[model samples]
Target: MSQTGYQSFEELIVWKKARELKNELFQLGKAFPPEEKYRLTDQLIRSSRSINAQIAEGHGKRTNKDKIKYCTQARGSISETINHLIDAFDCGYISTEQLKRYRIRFDELEKILSGYIKYLRSLPGD
Candidate 1:
């Protein structure tokens, strides 16, 4: 659907993907061992969710610079999420299939976000 009157990043494709990634990460956390419930699992889930949260917050800003700043933060959160996912995989908390799914989703989100960033840069402001 057209995002024409949608003033926030919550209505954007990348944000939706990030939100879905957060949900999946939460579900993935549930499969982890009980000992990790409050440790790596929690951290991973939080980081995943934060990415979209930052994007929404950024979109609320009136200026493109501020929006890009928040978008950068969101991207950083994505990196953190990817790192945590790698840690989970190395620790054997998730299977290869699960890792593949996360990577694929992250990649798509990254592309959308990157495109948005480029668009913002092309705006009148530096």
Candidate 2:
């Protein structure tokens, strides 16, 4: 979509991707053992959801600095989610195939976020 068309967070590619990733993670989380319902499951869910939450929150911040800060936090959340995925793999909660696919998703989200951050930084009036 064009920048002019971006009226809300829903119009953002990064936000959309993060939302999709969250859904995919939710589905995959279902396969984890029941014992992790409150542990790993919750952690994965929260981190994945935070990706988009940060973006939306950042967009609404009062200043560019605050917005950038929130965007950076969102980027960190993606990394955190990746670590959680690694832990899930180490614990045998997810298969190698699932881990690989999920890692790719996170990688894409990170790239989009990075680009968005760059765009934000390039804007005038810092």
Candidate 3:
């Protein structure tokens, strides 16, 4: 919890954005018909949230390599989420507007994650 020597990337910007995406995901899934509760709904929410959780886990690892690995996993989770979101749009589980919104956020995060990974890879003693 100490701020000493902590990286700026650990600030609330990324976490806040990810948290907002997770909330929107929850709302969108909740709007789905009850029949989907244990199916697409659950899957979508789980995958969406995993992206955020994995990033934080990676940060907590404190090793550049380990952090990069978790960020890679998070990127994979985001890809899976994008597919699910597309499916949700196709199935009318979500609006095209909602999909667009989530897509934009996901894309932004992807770029950030990619940059972080590249930066990590470029570090000495990796």
Most TM-score-accurate candidate: 2
Sort every candidate by TM-score, greatest first.
2, 1, 3
lDDT of 2 by residue, 76-99 (tens): 999999998998999998889988
User: Over the stretch 1-126, how does candidate 1's per-residue lDDT look in tens digits?
Assistant: 456755456668888888888998889899899999999999998899889888888888889999999999998998999999999999998889988888888988988898998888899973
TM-score-superior candidate, 1 or 2: 2
Q: How much is the lDDT of residue 45 in candidate 2?
A: 93
Root-mean-square deviation per candidate? 2.0, 1.9, 2.2
> Candidate 3 — which residues are off by over 4 angstroms?
1-3, 7-12
Off by over 4 Å in 1: 1-6
| Pairwise TM-score winner, candidates 1 and 3 | 1
Clashes of each: 0, 0, 0
Q: What is the TM-score of each candidate against the true structure?
A: 0.90, 0.92, 0.86
- Positional deviation of residue 5's Cα in model 3 after best superposition, in angstroms: 1.2
Report the C-alpha displacement of residue 76, candidate 1, in angstroms.
Answer: 0.9
| lDDT against the true structure, each candidate | 0.87, 0.90, 0.83
- The runs of at least 3 residues in candidate 2 whose Cα sits more than 4 Å from the true structure, single-residue gaps closed, are 1-6
